[model samples]
Target: MTHPAAPARRRFLISALSACAVGGLTTSLTACATSTFPFIPDYYTFSQKQVQEAVQRKFPYQRTVSQVFEVALMHPVVGLLPDTNRVSVRLDARLASPFLQQPVNGVFTLSSQLEYDPQSRSVVLRAPNVENVSVDGDAQAYTQQINAAAAVLATQLLTNYPVYTFKPDQLQFAGVTYEPGTITVLTNGIRVQIVEK
Candidate 1:
């Protein structure tokens, strides 16, 4: 025969389990609906390799200077200048002209600060300056000419050239529109801060 209190005990246990189950369900639903990951980033990041690849896409660029000398730029080596908040590109340059018996090779170094161009919706090189030009072999006679040509190349070829572009999805998050704000050059790559519109 069952104890006199067994039925009452079973009823109490059932009520307690039901209450616990309901509480657990409520907690689980709330967590699933209202929680977001704490580590989600507000800004987008680009690695050094990605920046290099983006810059590399524009090479090997070629242009004829003064209708006589042909300047072909290739093999870009990109470096981040965190101190000046700029980026540098050292390119291998080949110059050919009828005045020269053979083509002359040199290294052309250029640096520029980055800016967000609203028209282009891109991070572009702005006010590019020719840092240095070093010609190989006996091209001393053409040093001044080469330097001038390098300056032209830096201005004409790279100015307003895009290093990165924000995709449509990248500019939107959680039903909010965000645009790239301050851009910073770091030791390894670039950091673009995004702000809501």
Candidate 2:
């Protein structure tokens, strides 16, 4: 014969198991939802290689000397100042002319302050100072001439090397809009933050 409380006990056990299963599934889904939403970045850092490639690709090579002299401008190695708001530049130039008896190489270093322009939406590096100059052997004949030529190339670099730039219309993505704002110069790179809401 069945016990008097047997059916009630069996029903209670079934209810407990169903409740446990539903609770576990609910917890898993909540975890998934939290993981996918609500994320914001504080800053962005561009690497040395990335900066090099961007500047090299975007910065146009310019000829400092023409009819009378022959010289070609190349990309520069750029670095950020650790404590100061400055950028260090080192440029390499080659004296290429079929008429020349020997090849000559020139290296130049420039230091300049970085500035942000609101109108054009570009970072304009100020006019750079020539920190040092070195040229291949027996350049005394062209020392004065080369210095002038080097200055021209340095100016071009200071004017063209852009840390960051974004047009007003191009800043929107995925329901969020990125408007250009303040900038900070880091030791190895730069940070461009989005405008505050």
> Which candidate leads the pack in TM-score?
1
**Per-residue accuracy of model 1 over 1-197 as CA lDDT, tens digit each:** 75989888788766755665666652322222213322223466677788789889999999998787799999999999999999999999998887788898999999999999877779989999989899876666788888988898899988998888878766765777778888999998888877777
Determine which window of 10 residues in candidate 2 has minimal summed lDDT.
28-37
Residue-by-residue lDDT tens digits, candidate 2, 40-79: 3333445556556655664436563745456655767877
By lDDT, the best candidate is 1
Model 2 ranges off by over 4 Å: 1-43, 58-68, 96-101, 167-182, 193-197
In model 2, state the lDDT of residue 174. Answer: 60
Q: What's every prediction's RMSD, in angstroms?
A: 11.7, 12.7
- The per-residue C-alpha lDDT of model 2 at residue 143 equals 74
